[model samples]
Target: MEDNFSNALLLMGVGLTTVFAVLFLIIGFGNLLIKAVNKYAPEEEKPKLQAADNKAVASIDPAVEQAIDLAVQQLTGGKGRAVKIQRL
Candidate 1:
């Protein structure tokens, strides 16, 4: 009976230790990967022509716009409004 109790305690300690070790490794490796990527390949700004083109608005069908507005109002309990909608 004493041996069984000791064996159970040993297994529990080993299991908890293994779980914590794996978690620490995952967190450390993920942070290291993010840092390496950001250092080597930082974001670049869009070209001036593309940036200017983005400011121009295209025409939208009135019926489609109304449907989108109604959907947003119903979904958000009349609190949220659609700022932009794009087709995927």
Candidate 2:
């Protein structure tokens, strides 16, 4: 009975150690991959807002703007307003 208990404890220890080792290895590899990608990947350029976009937003129909304002007011419990509506 004593021998069996010792064997069980040993098996448990070994299993736990193996599981933790594998998890640590996976975490290390993931971190390394993230660092490598960030180093090698080109930074994306953001699109600049053009003057035409502002003109379009200013030219939006009053009815459509009212609808947008109503939707925003309802969605935000009448605490928010639609300041600018733009098209892509």
lDDT of 1: 0.69
Question: What are the per-residue Cα lDDT tens digits for candidate 1 across 1-88?
Answer: 9999999999999999999999999999999989998999765442222222233313455577567766887999876666565543
* C-alpha RMSD by candidate, in order: 11.1, 10.7
User: Where is model 1 more than 4 Å wrong at Cα?
Assistant: 43-88
TM-score of 2: 0.50
Model 2, span 1-88: residue lDDT tens: 9999999999999999999999999999999988998889754442332335777776777788778877987999876777656866
Query: In model 2, which regions exceed 4 Å deviation?
Result: 1-3, 49-51, 58-88
In terms of lDDT, the poorest run of 10 residues in model 1 is 46-55
TM-scores for candidates 1 onward, in order: 0.49, 0.50
lDDT values, one for every candidate: 0.69, 0.77
After the best TM-score superposition of candidate 1, give how far the Cα of residue 55 lies from its true spot, in angstroms: 9.3
